[model samples]
Target: MSSNAHSFYYGGKFLSKVTDLVRSEIEPIIAARGDEFVDIEYVKEKSQNYLRIYVDKDQPGGIDIDEIAALSEEVSEKLDSLEPDPLPDPYVLELSSPGVERPIKNAKDWEKANGEYIHVGLYQKIDGKKMFEGTLKSYNDEEIELEIKIKTRRKTLTIPRKLIANARFAIEF
Candidate 1:
């Protein structure tokens, strides 16, 4: 499953430095436009380097391509003007929305996901199940409540926050 959680290779000091530098340089510009910065990442794939920036609107309906294009240009210009380029290798910069099945990484993500359908993966089995798909009822620091279907009946499952290995929005067919 796709997730916003960075892989182990991306958690090193070098990647952390690049992420910090990019966030510090671009956050103010993004905030000035009244948009929320979801995340930023630097990764190497197929021998090529990539820098991706995820953004979303504070309101509903999400961001559009035009908005992404405008922000991309501004951020590109900002990076280009940095006195000493932080990245040692050339990388492609990408700006876009976190898609429908976006990973629930923080409080804001959980807040936005309330009442939405989601898939939760546990580090250990809960009720003999390691994974669950349900309508997110509520979430707080201690736990998350979901309304799940089982044999034609709906049940509420209270999952401890510590047990969740991953949680993300799920599209229902």
Candidate 2:
């Protein structure tokens, strides 16, 4: 309902500008530290405003708590020094990993997720389902082979690449 330079209120929420600015400003700082920036969320939970930063590494071990702590300190200092700060005081700045159930966001993520238990979201329903959880068998630019559970049996589904809205690593219980 309001607008400012590169910032706007959508659905009575001011998310875009703040998240965008924060993302842009901190990406270089994150990259310089050899970390991959996953996402940032600026939102209110209960009476508190939170700026939650999600970060991860492509390495086998993934990012650890010490790295998160160090990054949090550096990012806090960087935000505090910004003139005309977009973030209000009394807001919580949190930095953490996206964890094991993280989304497969790009080609690299896809490559890393091969043969792993995963979830896929589709734009349209297939077999009366828009979402599926299974082990990823294989993938190409054209499609993916997913081995899913049906009743007491396992079945492989060949889904069109274009139908995937998103994919993520999943936990099978």
RMSD of each: 4.1, 5.2
Clashes of each: 0, 0
Poorest lDDT segment (10 consecutive residues) of candidate 2: 1-10
C-alpha lDDT score of every prediction, in listed order? 0.85, 0.85
* lDDT (10s digit) by residue, model 2, range 32-107: 9999998777777788878889998869988999999999999999999766677755889999998989878778
Query: Compared with the true structure, what per-residue lDDT tens digits does model 1 show for residues 1-173?
Result: 22123322222334335677778889999999988898887877798878899998877788888999999999999989876677657989989898888889899889988999999999999999999999999999999999999988999999999999989899966
* Predicted structure 2, TM vs. truth: 0.80
Spell out the clash pairs found in candidate 2.
none
**Model 1, runs deviating above 4 Å:** 1-15
Task: Quote the positional error of residue 85 for candidate 2 in Å.
Answer: 1.6
Most TM-score-accurate candidate: 1
Model 1 root mean square deviation, Cα atoms: 4.1
